[model samples]
Target: MFNKWQAQRWWSENYDRIKELYNVQRLNRNAFALPTPPISEDEASS
Candidate 1:
């Protein structure tokens, strides 16, 4: 079984690599997402 110390050590070693991957994934998602058009005030009242 893995101990807490070992788990923490593993995360510490790989944190930056994992974080970089996560950031790339987020950027790709944002790049592909379409922007929503603003609704008119009149539409909100209906």
Candidate 2:
């Protein structure tokens, strides 16, 4: 259920909305916003 151009266009437009939703915003910020809160328990444990 995926088209190459359509997918590419999505990536080009939304960039990584899917990845962002999954919290995988590493290389792209066009669609994803970086996580600011601590992700590890070490900080909480401190």
Candidate 3:
């Protein structure tokens, strides 16, 4: 049988770990950052 309270309790218990994992993954993706695109000639003259 499905229990909503049980699901909520499990999620609450694991929320911190889930958030930490997500942050680590995001940081890893950002660490090897992409270079910005080159500016247009008109913009450079302004």
TM-score for each predicted model, relative to the true structure = 0.45, 0.33, 0.42
Ten residues in sequence with the least summed lDDT for candidate 1: 23-32
Best by TM-score: 1
After superposing candidate 1 on the true structure, give the runs of residues whose Cα lies further than 4 Å from its correct spot: 24-46
Give all candidates' CA lDDT scores: 0.84, 0.74, 0.83
* Model 2 regions more than 4 Å off: 27-46
**Per-residue lDDT of model 3, residues 1-45, tens digit only:** 549999899889998899897874435767689889999999999
Output the TM-score of candidate 2: 0.33
Off by over 4 Å in 3: 24-46
Instruction: For candidate 2, list the clashing residue pairs, or say none.
Output: none
lDDT-sorted candidate list, best first: 1, 3, 2
Task: Quote the lDDT for 16 in model 1.
Answer: 85
lDDT of 2 at 41: 89
Write the residue-wise lDDT of candidate 1 on 1-46 in tens digits: 6699999999999988998987744356578788998999999889
